[model samples]
Target: MKLLKEMIHPELATRTGRILRRHAARGIVLREQDQILLLFTERYNDFSLPGGGIGEDEDMELALVRELEEETGARDIQVKAHWGYIEEYRPYWKPDYDLMHMTSHFFVCDIAPELAEVRMESYEVANGMRPVWVSIKAALDHNLQVMSRQEETMGLSIQRETFILEKISREIIF
Candidate 1:
């Protein structure tokens, strides 16, 4: 896939002495007419695409399929196109690491007519995360609103999600 964007967090611009943990994640764009598949996290009061971390050595396609299933209960997923990837450098906040470099790959996909049950992780559950079919504009607007407030409830991935939502709205959904 091609590189879409590289976002270096403003806070990390002057920081140093940090260990790097490179993470690879995948997300999908599953659209039905005017609606798109998204994960709404009540805790963050924001929306994001349905996907998550890719395990070590996992195939990108496999990870996309697995993440769609795990996060949105999406079935019959067909990754139609490689949308591209976004790279982010942000605070890691772990004992051994102070920065994280993440590469998030995105795809344009098609899924079954009906969704099954979401198998969200424990943290997702605690955050009140649920699958929702919403317009790309809605997701983008809502995330931009949350980011403007810069609240404590905001999640780490919100910026990336908002950026992707904007890109999708412009490049695909519009």
Candidate 2:
């Protein structure tokens, strides 16, 4: 995978400590026109890609497929391309590490016409995470709105999601 972008938290720029690393695989499931699959997190008033952290010793593509199924109830998922990756260095929320580094791999994928009930985790359910096929611009605009307001409900993933949404808007072919 190629490095699409790298972002470093301002707080981590001059600070140093034990940095824990994590990896995630995200998918871009595009339909005809502007529709794209995404997770609409109501609690945060934001949207994110349908994917999650890669398990230890798991293949990235497999992780993407599994996550898509779990998060979006996607069927017949097929990863067609290694889109790119984004790297993020931020302050860790855990006590064990002072900072964290994460790489988010992205892939373009295809899914069957039908979907089933999502099997999201409890936290995701509590957070009102639901799978939806939304206009790429709608998700992006909504995320940008929440970000601009600096809402406390906004999650850290919103920024990354917004970035990818913008990229998709620009690069997605008609």
Question: Local error of candidate 2 at 125, Å?
Answer: 0.8
Which 10 consecutive positions of candidate 2 have the poorest summed lDDT?
A: 8-17
User: Model 1, which residues run further than 4 Å from truth?
Assistant: 14-18
Clashing pairs in 2: none
lDDT of 2: 0.90
- At residue 106, give the lDDT of candidate 2: 95
Model 1 steric clash pairs: none
lDDT of 1 by residue, 1-174 (tens): 699999888778544667574545455655567688888999989998887777788887898898899988889888888888888888877878778888888888888978899888899999999998898877888899888989888978888889888878777766
lDDT of each: 0.82, 0.90
lDDT of 1 at 124: 91
